[model samples]
Target chain A: MDIVCDKRAGGTLLQVNGRMDAVYAPAFEKECLLVIDGGEIKVVVDLTGLEYISSAGLRSILVSAKKAKVKGCSIQFCGVSGMVEEVFKISGLFTLFSIVPTVEEAFAA
Target chain B: MMKPQGIAFRLASLTLLVSTIILAIIVGYNYSVSRKIIVALAEDRGTLLAKSTAKKISTAFMTVQKVIDSVAFSLEDDRLTEKRVNELGQRVLINNPEIFGSAIAFEPFSFQHDNQYYAPYHYRLDGGPIVFARLGSDDYQYFYMDWYQLPRELERPIWTEPYFDKGGGYELMTTYTVPFYRNRDGQKVLQGVVTADISISWVQKLISSLSSREAEYVFLLSRYGTFIAHPNANLVMNETVFTAAESLEYPQLREVGRRMVAGETGVVELNDLPMTGDSFLYFSPLPDQHWSVGFVCSKKEMLAEVSRLNREVATLGGLGFVALALLITFLAKRITHPLRELTVSANDMASGNLEARLPEATTKDEVGELTHSFQAMRESIKNYIENLTETTAAKERIESELRIAHDIQMGILPKLFPAFPEHREFDIYASIEPAKEVGGDLYDFFFVDENNFCFLVGDVSGKGVPAAFFMAVTKTLLKVVAESRLEPGEILAKVNDDLAEDNKSCMFVTLFLAIIDIRTGVVRYASAGHNPPLLLPKNKDAEWIPPLNELVAGIMEGTQYTTKSMTMHPGDTLFIYTDGVTEAMDKMNNLYSEDQLMVVTNQCLGKSAEQLVDSVDKSLKKFTGGAEQSDDITMLAMQYLGKGSKQEGDDRWI
Candidate 1:
């Protein structure tokens, strides 16, 4: 899994790529945790390059979500569709946060 | 040599010490024996010379006295009185040729002389005519000399120590003086003494001729301790033994001189002499004159032959010692070389070179035995490693092939979600996780026809290649029957018959297969010894449908399955799974039973088919907490949306 974190206008743009299964979930968590630890409250995860994800990856995102909320920070996801979108919809995490179609729109939300 | 702790050095040193001690003993013995022999010979020669010289002096004195006695007896009645005394003395000198000089001295006034001293002394110059001198003068006090006074005091003829008679104008001489009487009264009266002068040259000549060796010198010392005749001309008649001992600083010479003067006969060893090396002095006293004859011999010259013998013995012993040392070194090396080779071989083995070879031992010693054992051990190690490597390779090959089979089996399952994307009537998703590299669980879905869709979840009877092969054949048969226009129940029943007809291995698959017509909003489902799916109604909680109680597929030839009909509402969902889901376990061996599945599904209300499956999967992983998955888990979920119904907002990207 490749978690590319970039600085944006309103937050850190974290681009998640590749299969975020149980083997790669910890790396996804660590990338988000580093941004939060650096005092960057607002985060945007770009799923444009993401090819696949599993339940273990979902758990990590859920934990990151709760942490961001408690810290008065917000996390938005952009560029999601197909199997990854269905995974979020089935796990009921689609209603938990703002999901946008593009990086610009995610940070705007 | 390896550590300076070998026996060769010890042997060499031992030989050195033993040979040194033996050589010292032999040399010391030789020295003492040679010294004793030389000293004994010297003492014997000195004693013989001393005795003969004393006898010669005595005989000379006796002959002169006898001649004087005969002359005195002839003159007793005035037969040629003092007129013939001179002629008689001349005759005595000519008769005794060994004497360098002969003299007859007379007492004064009674020998027909008018002077108070009428003594006449006659001595021959070397091989010359006899010279005469008158001793009647006061300066010629021959009447008071030891030659005159000592014999007169004892009333016997005595030989005097040799002395230079300068006043008498004679040679260095020893005088034998005897008294002659004249009848001046009736009682025996004192008359003129008769003296014979014997030159000391003859005795000195005797000493010189005694020995021919240069280091062996003979000398005589007077009773008064003066040197009389010595090889050293400066000491002859000039130095006494006491004075020479002090000047030479050879303290032992004092003892020698004392012994000589005391008429002692012995040999003394003198060490550290000035001009000569160590020497031995042998002395014997001439009692007639109380003089001593001594022979001096150098110790070096005396022991020269013994030293030569010592040198020869040392050379021979040294050669022998060298030979012994070489032999010992060679033998020691011969014994220890094999041990060194063994050490090297052992080191090579420790470094993992089992093929290292030791040289063959021919001696049948313990080293040879060790070599045989080591060879056997090496062979054993080689065989052991070869067997281990072969066994491990076989196991790895089997495991790798199983992994490839697992990949193929997992590939054949339908993994793409929303299986019918153009058909908005339903969304379906499924997944299969095997317990091992290859599993017995399988799930697949496809279009039976244009309007009818088919899907199924199943588990075979066992795990691994056999069950996986069986699962594949069963799955393919079902697809063929579904395409042949058979109902879901008939399709499974036909697949079962086809499978049971030729199946030699007793294998089975528990299947829950379904076909639905999206246009009619109806789902036709069948169960063959499989778990029923949960119907999650649009308005209420989900529930398990009653089982059809049919025989499982691939168990019997004519196993018939029953169908159940259910019309799905626009939002109703169907969740079907194998027993692996219900029987999933945690580390403590706690099972995720049917009750737990329902409890987990309660959180899936309003979720899509994919989300519902993922949520259950998440729950299984969570429940198990990373424990080993011991069974295959297979699940298929489908949500039906009735015709003409659509998502609130939707966009499909090309």
Candidate 2:
């Protein structure tokens, strides 16, 4: 799994690609924690290229969300579809957070 | 003198010799026969090719002849005069690409209005337009030329010998001439000659493309043996086959020319032809021309196909012979592989390795049968030996195990009587006596800290080696946990969790674990489904303590056990033992229960810890009444007298 981050006008755009299984979940969580700790308040996760995600990956995202909320930072998601969307729906994360069609729309919202 | 290796080498050599000799004879014979057949086939092919070429040349001559006749007939027309003859000649030259040029020449005073001996010629120059010129030059006279004189003499059409018309047609060419005369008072008088020129290059192109080999070629020869349209440009119109015969002093070359120029059509093999070397020649004559077309190919070139085939055949034959020899060697080994294996196996079996096996043989031949027989023999012998070995091994194993288990169990017990003889504050004793070859009953007591004494008695779930192994694990776990200085309950909990993890065998132990404070006489004990101790007080009754309601150790993970404490006065004893003592069955099947153990403990009131434990063991032995002990019997007794001073030396009691 790859986590690529770049700064945008509205926030930091974090593009995640490849399968976010249990193996890569820790690194993803660590990077997320580092980003939130660094005070980058607004973040948009672009998951358009994400192939699959397991429960461990979702747990990492939840941890990131909670930590970001406590730090007064925010995270939005975009390009949610395929197996990643299926995992979100099954894990009830679909209605739990913000999601949009594109990175631009995600930040705009 | 012939060993196995020697015989193989002999066989290979003999086979190679025979194969090489036979291959040489066959290749030699095949080469001779194929050479003869190929040469014969080439002769037929050459004769057919020459005949076809002769037909083509004849057609070209007839075309030129027709054109000359056409020009001669046109001269008889009154509308055509000497003035317009050049124009007609130019038209004839331009109409046929095959014709190099054409011309019409008249005699002197033939036409009264024309100049005497006037002639006009039109011919192509290096692929340009037809060039017109008068033939009246003093240096070259047209009337004296053979093309003019011959037809004038014969008063007929004739083809001239092919020549390099350098100054006339400007090419190597042949000319066809037709003479025309005008009737003078019914007496025909000679007028002039009409000539049509054809480039020999057209015939040369047809002949050169016919042969493929460099040494094989076709050429044209005139009636007088002059070279015409030969593949060798130097020989065309320059040297003849007769001249070559004369130069090389080989008369066969002239004979070949005679054979062609006589209008003969046949294939001739001349072995000593000059310039041509040994060659095959075929000739045929052309119509309306005194010329013969012949095809010649060197004998070496004709037999080149046979030589190539001979080399290929020899190579293939040798390769095939080598392949056959290798296959024979491989097949011999295949037939003998089983026998070789059997030899090795028998040797190994003699050397006392019973695991040696016969190689499998799928063939039903003698070797295969021998292999199967050997397999059966080996199996039976191996089985008989193994059976005897297993019986002896079982007995020895049991005896050794009993000896080892007895030694280990006794070694682990606290054999020393006044276990704390130097301290004088307490006395402890322990022993384990197994009923069978091996047992799992255990008892241990050690000082954990300066003020605390750790004690434990355990019986693993089963008997024999498995139970003994679990007992060892439990003892070690308890000892390690006790060193943490935790409470009895916490220590037992930690030991239980550690042992329960990865306890796939599901073996468990019932233990009474305790920590005693010597200075305070306070005893805190935790029990895991064990028989409680009999507490003996001074001047009071000895009684059995109630059991702790806890599961056995190693049964589960994270099981919590609670501790129970009791304050003891001085001169009190806690006697701990497994059910092996209380449940001991006599010859009459009557068990010595808890009440009996309490009574026996009370009877040893004034004894030391070692004496108390010894007395209990003696009672249990007597109660069994000579029957084999049913289970492992283990016991531990600790007596708390008074707190002895730290400086006191109590070596007298040991």
Candidate 3:
């Protein structure tokens, strides 16, 4: 998995690619936590190229979201589609955090 | 024929070579030095002998000259008669035994007028009685003889070359002659000659007696280089030193001969003489006779004693070297003996024999220290192996216990088929395969009342024993809460509150719980962050039952859950599964996504629930193609049949 972080006017944009299964899930969580620890009040995670996710990946997302909530930081996800969209809907993660269709939409929100 | 390859052999051989060279140098040097000293001493002795012999011969000649001089002085008397001359000659002969004869010869008509040759002679034979005779007859003219004529011409006394006197003395002799003069009217005129004769036999005997050693000999040379007395009698008086040198092809001997005749006295080495091999010649001249004496000593005979002594010392040194080589080899072997034994023991240990016997370290040396260290190493290895064996056995026991736990977990899953046999309105089948010996995936079904059947499928956050325990608690709480005959969402809410009360580990389970009303074919279900189930209509395609918006159970307390209802026709089927089904990975790490699940479920629209579950399991296995199941795969399929739709010959439900 690869994660590319970009600084934006409103938040830090983190673009993640490849698998987010049990093996690579921790990398995404670490990227999210790093952006939050760098004093960014908002984080936008772009998973447009993410192809698959496991239950372990969902747990990492939940843990990251909880940590961000405790630190008064907000984390948003964008580019959810296909299997990733189905997983987010089933796990009720759509209700837990703000999700948009693009990085620009996340910044506008 | 293979040479010795041991260090002992090499050490001994090296020592022998070095010592042999050193001993050879010492013995050789000693032999050469002693040889020089012995040769020098022989030369000195020879020189001394030649000088002494020359002095003795000189003294004898001086005595003969004194006698001859006194006789000639008396012959100068003016009134001397032949009788007086004969008396003078006899007196000279009787007084000197070495002289064989004496003669007094006058000038022609000078002594007696009538006779032309006139002389008188007196002599003796081998110390016998003295005999008197006339020395000058017609056949023996004294004036023409070398003894008389040399003194007349030179006007001085002289010794003549040796010759045989036939008529006068009848012996081989050399004469010493002196001239007498008369003072006639103030002019000195030669009157006659007087002589004393010495036999050459007496001189030869004297010269031959001077030699002391067996290989040593002496020779006498005349002033003209003639061999007067020599070891070879044939050469005496016959061959001169130059003729002998020519016959022998010895130029060095000829050189020495020249020096001798020139009255030179010294020692020289004669190396070119074939008869003498190598020799030293000591020559000296007789002072009065002008004769030379030579002493020849062979160098080989001179150094014989020194050579023998050197041979004995070398032999002893050889014997000592042999003994030293043997001693060195024995000492080297003794030192390396323990090392050889250690090699054998180490080989045994290398071949997996930890109990190989080690040689005792008796001495406090390097080999001994190595042996001690080896024994210590062996002991440590043995202890380490023992500890390793014990740890492995403990791990095996834990593995076996996990197998039993897996069995118990499977046993609690309601595995009996044809469950609720008397009720033929629905058919359900479920299976759970853990990725490990135990897993956290579970599926359970139980009737909360005679008209209500509740079923649940759940997956904990992770795998293994902790997840399995959480799964069990969730299943039990769902069963307990369902017994209260509440709605699906109310039951899930109560169970989640009970689970989150002590969930410090933050572990949670995704659960889908539902109750089917067999009388009306109405299904009410709630999902606690679980995957949505696929619904397969008897005559249409498969579609998912949209999931509720709720967090997974055991994450937080007081989390409310909402229930959704669905009406199923007589041949419709519902399939629920954990993410282990859809997220199952192939060797390429590609997931068996929900799209494949939807296609396979549509194909199983008219199949029984058991057939549908088996088809999906086989499809997953085929897609994975021996890839390791990285998660637990739990699947449940239920097909509802309207009331009174039981088929004939399907008495499996009876």
Candidate 4:
């Protein structure tokens, strides 16, 4: 799995690729933690390449969101597609966090 | 003693045997070559001597034949009478002293030779000469009356028999005669014959010298096979032939002799001998004499060299035997010395001294390398044994220390069950069993006020003394916070701060604490990442009542704890436990899962607090088989019956 990150306009953009199962979840959590700790107030995770998501992967995402909240950083997820979108809707994570279709929409949020 | 030494001995022995066999073969060949050389030399010398004798004899025969031919030619023509013939004879005698006398005879009394030409002389039988006119009662027996008549019959010059000569009158003499024709008709015509009367002493002397050398016999034979001069004088002038040639055993030699008579000169063996040894004869035919000379020498004498060779081979064989013996002894010692040392070293190593090392020599041969390998193996084994001993001792020591820690951990739990035997506000029971040397599960309950009882069950993560230490700290902090007159939520908040203040290694604990008002059966509870406790209603079914709160207690500093309140009805029981109780596993790896735990807890819904704990414990054992508990299984059960006097049969609840 690949997580490409770029910073623009004082916000972090993370592009995640590949399935986020139990094996890739830990890396995703570490990436999100690094961004939050950098004092980035607004961060975006692009899940356009995400094909599938397991419960453990969702839990890592939620944990990262809570960690960001504690640090007073706002996290937004964009480009959610495939099974990752369905998992978010079923887990009620979409109600808890902002979701956008593109990176521009995430930055606006 | 060792395999290499044994092989070396066999190899050395084999080498010795091979060398000995080769030496024997060489000795045999040398013997054969020397014998051939000696035989060749003997044959060459024999042939050379025989040829020298033939050359000398030929020269002597030429001189003698020449002298005889000159005398015969001188007498060939006779122009005078008997008086001149006698004068010629005397002259011949004076000129050639080697000739005894020369005489001439004429048939019909017409001869002139010697002194008794036509005289009527009588031959003397004893020693005297007699006048022919005074012969004893015989009237003038003339020359025709003598043995000379025998020559006239044959008509050839011949050597007459030895007789007492009246003319010479001293020694026995034989007459050599030659007959000739007086006319041109080429017939004898009764011409006078010339006679030479020679002494036999010279022929005897020649035969004696030739026979004196080493089994050699010289003999002369006439052209008609008559023995003239021989080693046996009696056989001289006798008509004799080689009788052995007629024997069947000499058929090959007979054939050879026939060819020899036809003038072949080579080698032939005389096989027909009456007790005569093996002989090799070399024959040379004399050209003028019409006779042959043969040298008969024994074959043993010609090949005496082979005997000398036998003696030389004996000497060489003796030397070879001595050399072989010395080499075998020396080789045995040289080969076995190293082997003996190796044998002793092997014996020492077999006796279980891993430290025992074979001595290595400085050479780079196989034996030296073997010694180095053995020493290296010994050294490695010693090091391995030492390391194994230390590791085993260290493991035992650690296990013993862990056992002590486990005992200390168990001692910390409240071993005195049924702490209040007389109080009847609620019936309560609790148990804690650590999984390892130490565990993080802890249970505590104390009366916060006259009406309120503060009870809690918490499990810290991980195992060992660290978790044990953390559980102790958390339990102590909970007690301190409970005495501060705070509610369940506030008490948890205070404890969390105290535990997380100096926390390293990210250690945390999951806790469920509740404060109950036994008078009203009202309880307030808070959770910190802990599974919810099960509550059994008095008339309804027992179920899990989950509390809503974020993970508190060491997860983050200043993390708040929240509480949920519930009013208890009569005979209702509350069960609180660490996850160890639900997460326990069997040998099949199936868990005492939470779903199973809930079903079991609801089975005895209306049971008292102690009955509820007992039923759950029994169910956990049945579900887990005989598999050991994998964690600290700690539980606290409490019940609140309605605050009133009960019936007589309900006394067991008090």
Candidate 5:
């Protein structure tokens, strides 16, 4: 998983590609916290390149989202496709997070 | 050849040949017996039918000829007159079984033998010989030059060409004439001609039926080759003579005719007649005539015997060939079973399954020898792997022990940050990760007095237990001097004196010791030939403070070390580290240089002492990126956050 922050939108864009499973979740969480603790809020996580997200990956995202909320930030997701999109929909996180179809839409919002 | 496939092929060949020969014998014997029985049965029926037909025809011919002879004797030798001759001809025609009619012809009477002379036989209107000696004036002139007189001049028995009788419209009649002669005087006097005006329809029907029914043909030829008995008698009498030798298509039949004309009778092949693949030819001479009869049948009928034999032999041969194949395959498998086992074992060995052993064999063959070699190989491999595993375990144990030793050596150093927690004037941090099980690098920091904080970082020569022990001792003795009343330079000098006195191993430590006055941020540091610690000036680039002496620890005891003072302004940072810190490796094996450390210190130049340390640690990690550290690394940092910004609760940053 790769994360790039755009300060203009006050959002961190996480462009994850390939499998985000149990082994990669911790490192992903640590990196997410690094950006969160930097005091940026209104985070938009771009999942356009993310091919898969398992339960562990989802849990890590929720934890990071909670941590961002504690720091007075909101994490919006965008460009969810493939199994990752289905997972988000099934978990009802599609309704929970501000999910948009593209990164541009999320950034605009 | 000794090759097993060769033996198999040879055995198969031998078995096939033997079975074929046996099959041939059985089939030939059966066919010969069957063919003999069939041929004998056919020949018996054919011969019986042919001979019986010939006898019946001959008996009828003789009886008819005898009746005609009796009529001729009555007309010529009995001196019968024309009326008597006519009556006798009528009686012959009526009494004979086969003669259709009999008649006589003689010269007109010239008053022979006192007016009692013989006359020719006469026939009535119905074509019977009428044996009358005279003709009535109105009886159709029976004695007026008979037609048989003309044919009588011919030397041979003349069969007059058939002529139609007007009285019997479309009825064909022909006369067979014979001359009557008197004996005893040898006179050439012709008494009269005896003739028979026989109806030829019976002979015509017989010949027509004979040739017209099937492929069989019969035609009579005179001695001069004239056709006599024929289906169309008039055609034979009118047309050219029938000759079998006139054809090119029947050269063999011509040979048969030649032989018949030469009086030789037997059989010969008829190369013509559109004979099939093979055919049988039979020829026989008719008795008392130059004519011969030829018969031909397809030879397929004759060779059916051989064809049946061949078919049976082929079937039996196929069965025998199948048996031979099975036997060869079975025998080959039996011969190669042991070799196949050996091959399997060999393959197993090649695939690294060395535990696979050939099965025990009692046969004293090359395969058994191979089994022995395989067993040996298996045993050797097992022993070698066992030894390898033991060696690997031992090496692991040694490695873990070395790791423990390394930790214990680190435990000997001052590793904690803020060594004097209550001293706010000086913020101190140090860290170490050894390069190996143990090394001689050491760093120490403690408060020497209420106003002075003391710390030393050093690297010893060589490594492992000897260097680590010397590090421990030197660290202890440095503390002893610092606890006494010595400055940083004097403490290192005293420790050097004590360390060099017993330095038999000739090892040394490059050290930089410092004392900081907490109330003023003035740090007085001394170095013994080590990399200078970093100092960041207020609003300036960080620089390394030059060491004051050339002596390393554990060298000559009298070596003098000098001291340099750096007065830290408020909000200025100071960083110090051993050479291991600057010399630490990154992923590419590039050193984390002093310039990089200087940048680290200056980047946090205005931050508190703790932030300076944190920045350096972060930079080190970013530069390392999972590269194995190569030396014992230690760094000490301090900063003056200044008195005005030092809030009561946040004074921890000072």
Candidate 6:
């Protein structure tokens, strides 16, 4: 898995790609906490290039969201589709965090 | 055994070789230069001796000639008598001891008118009394002798060649003869001859005394090259220099003899002379006698001191070379001692003794640095091995514990087959297989009442020990809620609320819970974000129950669940499973997807619940083709027989 972080007008953009399973899930969580800890009040995680996500991946995202909430940092997810969208709906992560269809929509929200 | 040719040996040998060559050059040069100097000095000494001896002989001859000239002047009177001539000759001999004899003879009948033989000689015999003899008889014809005849013809005073005078002196001698003349009527007439003879014994003594060394000898050669005085007494007057050169077959000696006879004075090397191996000859002519004196010096005797000096120098140089070689070897060994010790220590280390003692680094050099590095390397390797051993032990302990946890989790599931055999109304079988030592997947079945049998299959989010614990908690809460005889939806709602309370980790389980009434063939089930179960009727294709879009349990609090009812005919089976079946992957990462799961389940339509679960598992294994199972797999199947269906031995169903 790979994560590319970029500074945008709306927030810090974290573009996540590759399989987010048990092995690589910790990397995504660490990336999210790194942006939040760096005083980023708004962060957007783009999963447009994500191929697969396991339950462990959902757990890491939930853990990162909770840490971001405590720091008063908002983390938004964009490009939730395919197997990742199905997992998000079943795990009730859709009701817990803000999600959008694209990176621009995530930034606007 | 031969020792190793190490640096010390090589260094010492090189030093010895170089110094030996330099010593040889120095000694050889010294020997050659000194030999040259000695030869030159010997030549000068020989020339000086020859010249001085010749000068002394000339002075002695001049004194004897003066005495003889005085006797002849006295005999030149016109009124002289024979008795007066005898007295005059005797007087001259007595006055000069160097003159051995004196003679006065009248020219045949010139001294008297009738006297044909008239000569008188006076000589001393071996420094004895002077004896007078008349030498005018037939036995001793003094007028015909060279001394008398040569003066009459030449009319001048002259010295004869050295000879053994048998008739007069009877000894080896040479004579100086002078002719006297008388004036008669203003014309000069030859009166007689007057002569003085000198023995050559004194000349031999003088030549012998000129030599300063034992190997040096002096010789006197006459005008005809005869040996007048020589080191060998027999060769004197018997052998000339030319005869000795011929007998020895020495051309160079013959050339020296020729030069001396020609009155030339010089020094030459007498290499061809017999007995005298190498020598130098210096020859010079006497000023008065036309004779040459030669001084011979042996070259070996002259340079004996130089040879001794060279021997001593070579001995001392050899001793010094040995000492230098020893010192070099000692110093070289001292320098390499540390390296030898290092080799031993390195060998010990290579043989697996990490704690081998290293040589102390006394000097701050490369060897010292190498020793320090080796020590550091040993310590690092030791620490690395210690850390690896400790980590392996800890990991083994955790793995053993995980195995135990897996056993406990498996014990909680309903594994026994033929459940509720006395009722004969339904058959249930469930199995849970964890992907790891302990997993989050679980299945349970139990009688909630006499008529109501409740069963559930759940998948906790994430895996391993944490999920396993969450699954256990969900199963316990689910059992408690289901025993209250509430609907399946109510039991799910109550269990979800309990699990969601203070759930800080956001952990949840996807569950499909159901309650079946055995007599009525009525089933009421609810799913909390779980995969819908498949309904398989006997001799009919399998179909999936419609799923509710409800969130998985244990995520949000107070989430309501709705129960859906399905009536099962006799010989109908209901199958439930976690996503481990559908999401299983092959080596190519292709999923054993839901479509494949449906196809395999449809094929196993008439199989018992236990057989159905086994067939699905086999199909999954076949589809994955040895790829690692990424999650826990839990499967539960139930078949309802209905109220009227009774067991007829082994042929009740199927």
Please report, in order, the local distance difference test score of every candidate based on alpha carbons.
Answer: 0.75, 0.78, 0.84, 0.66, 0.62, 0.84
Q: How would you encode candidate 3's per-residue C-alpha lDDT over B291-353 as one tens digit per residue?
A: 898888777777778889898989999899989977887887887788788989999999999
How much native contact recovery, as a fraction, does model 4 achieve?
A: 0.00
Off by over 4 Å in 4: A1-109, B1-395, B449-451, B536-542, B567-572, B585-592, B602-632, B639-654
Question: B245-349, model 5: which lDDT tens digit per residue?
Answer: 453345554555555445444444444354243444443444433433333444456557667776877787788778877887687666667777777888988
Q: Which candidate is the best by DockQ?
A: 6
Looking at model 5, residue B450 earns an lDDT score of: 72
Lowest-scoring 10 consecutive residues by lDDT in candidate 6 chain B?
B644-653
Q: Each model's TM-score, in the order given?
A: 0.51, 0.42, 0.59, 0.48, 0.50, 0.59
Q: For model 2, give the TM-score of chain B.
A: 0.48
For all predictions, the C-alpha RMSD in Å is: 19.1, 28.3, 8.8, 12.6, 21.9, 9.0
Q: Which pairs clash inside model 1?
A: A90-B611, B107-B192, B117-B136
lDDT of 4 by residue, A7-107 (tens): 88959999889766546778988998998998999889899987655444665676787788889998999998755765465333565678889999888
Model 6, position B386: C-alpha lDDT score:
91
Task: For candidate 2, list the clashing residue pairs, or say none.
Answer: B108-B117
**Model 5: DockQ against the native?**
0.01
Model 2 lDDT tens row, B1-654 = 223564445576677788888999999999999988988788787788788778876776777788889889988765675558777888888777777788787877675555666777788877677788777567777788888889999989888887776447768878888998887788888888888887788668866765445336788888888888776688788888799678778787788888778888998888865456788888888857878888787887778778899999988997988897887666666666677778899899889986887687789999899988888888898898989899899989989977987787677667776676677777788878876767778888899999898988887754667777877778888888899999998988899899889865556677898888989899999987566678988668897766555766775688777899997776788888876787677987677877788888878776777788888888988999899776688888877765863333133233
Residues A51-72 of candidate 3 have per-residue lDDT tens digits of 8777777777777777788789
What TM value does chain B of candidate 3 have?
0.62
- Of the two candidates 2 and 6, the one with more favorable lDDT, higher being better, is 6
- Show the lowest summed lDDT stretch of 10 residues, model 4 chain B: B128-137
Any residue pairs clashing in model 6, and if so which?
A: none
Show model 1 residue runs off by greater than 4 Å: A1-109, B1-80, B131-133, B180-186, B212-215, B319-654
Model 6 docking tier (incorrect/acceptable/medium/high):
medium
